[model samples]
Target: MANTTVPEVFATETPEATVEIDAGAGKHVEPMLWGLAPYQWVSISMLVLLLFAFFGAKVHKTIAGGLDGKIAAIKQQLDEAKQLRAEAEALRKEYADKIAGAEKDAEAMLENAQHEADAILEKAEADSKAMVERRKRMAEDKIAAAEREAVEDVRNRAALAATSASRKLIGEKHDAEADKALADKVIAGI
Candidate 1:
C-alpha cells in the first residue's frame, strides 16, 4: 500500500499573489522600515546629532542676546549715576554760594547798623555840647543883668543920701524946679 498519506514534506515557503498596477498609479513610493536595525540606528544617531547641533546654536545665540542686553542695561545705569552725581555736585556748589552770599549780607547789615549807631552817638554828643553851651550863655547873660540891677540900686541909694545931706546943709525946702535945674547943670558940665 502506497503510504496512504503520500509522503508529506516540510516546507517554509510563502505563496505570492500578483497585484495589478494601472498606468495612472499616482506615484511610486519608498518603503518604510517597520523595525530598527544596526544600520538604521547609525542613521538615527547622525540625525539626532544634527538636530542637537542646530538647537544648541540657537540657544547660544539667545544667551548671547540676553548677555548683551544685560550689559547695555548696566552701562545705562552707570551713566545715570554719573549724571546724578554731577547734578548733586552742582547743587552743592550752589548751596555753598548761597550760604556765602547770606553771610555777606549779614555782615553788610551789621556794618550798616554799626555806622548808624556811630552817627547817632555823634549826634547825641553834639547835641549835649550845644545844650551845655546854650545854658552857659544864658547863665552869663542872667548874671550880667542881675549885676547891672544891683549897681543901679546902689547908685540910687547913694544919690538919696547925698540929697538929704544937701538938704540938711542948706536948711531949705528942696523944690522940684531947683533940683531939676541943678541936676541938668551938673550933667552938662561933666
Candidate 2:
C-alpha cells in the first residue's frame, strides 16, 4: 500500500490537499434486503400494496361503482331538468293561447260596443228629427186655428152693425101715413 497526495480545487478562494490510498478501488457494495436494493424494495412494496388494494379490498370496484352512481345521478338530474323544461314550455304555450283568446274577445267586445253606440246615435238623431217635425206641425195647426177664430169674430161684429143701421133707417124713413099706406097695400095684394 502506498499513500499519495493530490491537490483539489474548490469553488471558493481556497485550495485543499487530499491524501489518496488504494483501498478496494473499483469494487462497490450496497446494503440490500432479500437480495434487493433499497429503491427496488420500495418499488416492490408499492406494487404489493396496489395488488392488495385491488384484490383484497376491492377498492377499484368501489371507486368505479361510486363514479357510476354519480353518473347515474347526473343522468337522472338531466332527465328531470328536461321534463321541467317541457312542462314550462307547455305552460307558456297555454298562457300564450289564453292571452290571444283574451285579446280576440276584447276586440269583439269593443267592436260590439262601437256598433251599439252607432245605433244609439242614429236612433237619437232620428228621434230628434221626428220631434222637431211634430213641433213644427203643431205650431202651424195653432196658427190656422187662431186665424179662423179671428175671421169669425170679425164677421159677427159686422153683422151686428148692419142690423142696427137697418133698424134705424126703417124707424127714420117710415112715418105714420107711410106705415098705413104700406099696410093697406100688403092687405089688397093678399
TM-score of each: 0.45, 0.51
lDDT of 1 at 114: 100
Clash pairs detected, candidate 1: none
Mind giving the per-residue lDDT tens digits that candidate 2 earns over 8-28? 633322122222334666533
- Candidate 2, residue 132: Cα displacement in angstroms equals 1.1
What TM-score would candidate 2 get against the native?
0.51
lDDT of model 2 at position 179 = 88
Candidate 1: C-alpha lDDT: 0.82
Clashing pairs in 2: none
Please give the CA lDDT of all the candidate structures.
0.82, 0.83
